[model samples]
Target: MLCTDCLALRDQVAIYENELDMLHEEHQTQQLTDIQQLKGVKNPRRSGTGQLGSLRADRHVFISDSGAKGTIESLVEPSDGVATVTVEFPTPDVTPTILGIKEYYCQLEESLQFEFKATSAVSLGDHKVAELAKGPKVAVTDASKVTDVGELKNLIAELQRELADLEKCGEELEVEIEERKEVYLEEIAELQVRRPCGDSQSPPAIGWTCVCSCVTLCCVEELENAQADLDTQMKEQCADYDELLSEKMALDIEIAAYRDLVELEEDRLCYL
Candidate 1:
């Protein structure tokens, strides 16, 4: 027969175990949802795979601004919702150039001209990062992929480096976008203020109003289109960031489990 204190401790332990089980179930469900999202079910922006959907290494691209032709060396996905493409030109004298993903269009015969360009958008916040850290473990790297613990550690280190780069890129892009937006906004305001008022003596005020209205309509349409494109790009970047974060979290969990297994094996050996 257990004492009252002993019975109380047992009850507490049972309750704790039940709570843990519920948490585990919730985690599994979240993982399923995340996997489905990564598969592009929830994100219509994700098309194809491998870095911004078809912007993979070795793809030929043309820099529209400079008219320089080159093969894609790599695509750096931005944290601030922009994509940067590194291109290697055939001319040895010409150093490999990095351009905004929008600056270049894919030259693939099957691929349509990609109109999407990276713009300034929301920055991934610390709170969001913390929330993602609690998400279910995703199997980013298979256990069989690494033959030894050393190899696994190396892979994790590489991933950490990539994650750091992405975070830095996001910060820089955010600042740049804000500055560009401000400058453009100022210019637009100045243009509006400087517009010549229709002279009552020459052109009728009504005719001037009509001309101004047409110009305003065109400008409004252009701005609307630009804003829509920016929103789409932002969504795409957020999805990419989430997918990468999930992968990193999964790898971290895998390493932790591996360590636990090793420790358990060591304890069994000691008892033997």
Candidate 2:
């Protein structure tokens, strides 16, 4: 087919894609609003009833019974004189969300067909803050033996070191994200320049097969260029929007990771 026809067809396709993208984005905004509400839910449990709500403090058992009835005072060791007895906390079934926050965002995105190809990069960073976080990595911090000035000083020093390191890492990530954004903007500009067409470009100045009057041809050419320019701008703007959306998702994942860390620390506490 002629370039004229091909260009027209491409323009038509661009128009359809633009409309599709707009509707998809609107729908996604609405979905995000709903998810935000769910995330902010003050309490998932009823005020009076106890039907497994998140607000209720779970059972914290202080006794264990492997061979005898579970009680606060039960022999946890064998009758043999050589073995010493140990008291264990009662275990309560704690079920975490089978899906991580990042996964939840992904699932939410997938539920919408229009945002089909939203594959964002994933990042896993190590802050080694488990000690300061009172996580499983540093159970020694939980010991009650450290009461002297020297012991307390050492623990405080360790905690301060870990906190400073974590803060430094966070600053580094912020710098990295800023650099990434600079690169992203440059790429978007390049794409705009090379994109197929834009709104500034208009239809052909002449007829499909024949050259019309100079004035008429020029007029048509002006409109065609205007349309092309507009199209390019629209596409580039959409690209930037999508990138920002992905960045937002990445941030939410970090927040969720912190929440998970909290839950993990609580697990260790229950053990203690």
Candidate 3:
């Protein structure tokens, strides 16, 4: 008793439902892959060759606050996160200066209490000792005086603004994804309701079944094309979302580093 157009609409709905299920499965697999990739990535800040990695014994460096040239005697990391660095000056009468490193690095100009400039050689050894004894000491730049507090504040503020912007973009993308899903669902529902058989109550005319079959075939082809386009778009959106998340993670690390630097600077100023 079913008309040709009604049967075609039923077939279209089944095909669409199957494609929707496949798309959902594909999206879940893609999400799992993205998560695995994220886990495999290593944070660059904690790497061996990072800024803090250069701290070692016998390295020639000059204190930024005090223009005192010295050699690192030892670097120790205790149970506490803060590290301790012992620097030995050439004068036998002068005692070694013990510095606390709260995630501190020598080369950064932002360092308030201490800044270390590492020489290429591990130990200048006796040559540096002899040179120090000769009394024409190596010139040490007062990096603390050159550091601009205002500039650091501005940099931190800029980084915070960028982080906020990225967060907003991520939220927008999520909303967009939801909106696209709703739109696709609405379109599918509309297609079902607009079927020729659903609108017309009268009996079929001569050769009407043939015309309905041709129309149904065309609709099915269009539906397949639309599904393909939707799948491609969803994949692209997911990729973009993943990329944004990675960038957000990097920004979070960078923001933490800058905050640490600011805190260290403030601590130094409090003691002064």
Candidate 4:
């Protein structure tokens, strides 16, 4: 239906359109590549000196993605809009621990406190028991000539009063310790607000030095007074505890001796 020249022109036109379509697709591909490269690029804002502060081009930037590890060799943007991303092929395979470092430290601190309290209590109890043993032996020797039930009853009542006083002293010391911790924590919180991230010269920072120091000193003085009070109370209570223990040992000996005398008297009557 067509001549040879016409058919040849049609063939040339079809080839040209195919080549243009191919060029358009190649251009689209190049654009997409450029876009992807720009996605990861970042511009470091210049500081007052026209130089980037705290932005080191050679600093190693750690990157982990999809089990792949990499280091950013340089963050400088190039003329052709491509970033030099240096990446190592394989990453170290370290198993994760059940507890993080912060949690582990917290748990460790708690355990140490528990251990300290438990050890101190046990040692004090053992020492007191040893002292009581010595007291009872001495009391037995002294009780050979004493035999008064009324006197023993009075000694028992006095020991109970001393125990109650010691318990009250211990309770007061515990309350003071709690209060000291609270005041210290409050001071720490105030310090944190005054200087966040350890930057003392931060903008808009209020001058809190005078007031904070006064408050802190007051708290420290209170803590010191409480500690002195606790020391005095402990000394007084320990002395009282020792004296009461000795008296209790003597009372117990007197009671036992009296019981033996009564039994002996009863046996003599039965013989009659």
TM-score (all chains, Cα) for each model: 0.29, 0.28, 0.26, 0.29
Give me the displacement of residue 212 in model 2, in angstroms.
11
State in Å the error of residue 132, model 4. Answer: 29
In order, what lDDT does every prediction score? 0.43, 0.41, 0.41, 0.47
Model 3: ten consecutive residues of lowest lDDT: 91-100
Q: By TM-score, how accurate is candidate 4?
A: 0.29
Better of 2 and 3 by TM-score: 2
Tens digits of per-residue lDDT, candidate 2, 1-272, equal 12233344345445644654565466556545754554444433343565534321122234334322122222222222231222333333222332243355444444432342332233434523222121122222531233344555565556555445544544554565466556655654564455455454423312311332344446545544443443443343344445444434544554575577467547634543
Ranking by TM-score: 4, 1, 2, 3
Give the per-residue lDDT of model 1 (tens digit) for 153-201.
6666655655554455445545655666666566556655655666653
lDDT of 4: 0.47
The regions of model 4 sitting more than 4 angstroms off are: 1-211, 255-272
Name the best candidate (by TM-score): 4
Clashes of 1: 0
Please give, for residues 1-272, the per-residue lDDT of candidate 3 as tens digits: 11232344345445644654565466556645754554444433344445432332234545545443433344433223343444343311111211222222231223211212232234544522122111222232222232344544454454445445444544554565566556655655565455465325423432454465556556555544444444443443444445334434434554575575456545433422
Listed per model in order, the count of residue pairs whose N, CA or C atoms clash below 3 Å is 0, 27, 0, 0
Error of 1 at 5 (Å): 48
Superposition error at 78 for model 4 (Å): 99
* Candidate 4 residue lDDT tens string, 72-144: 3443444343544443223321212112322433443465456446645864433231222111211212321
TM-score of candidate 3 on Cα atoms, chains taken together? 0.26
Candidate 1, residue 249: Cα displacement in angstroms equals: 1.6
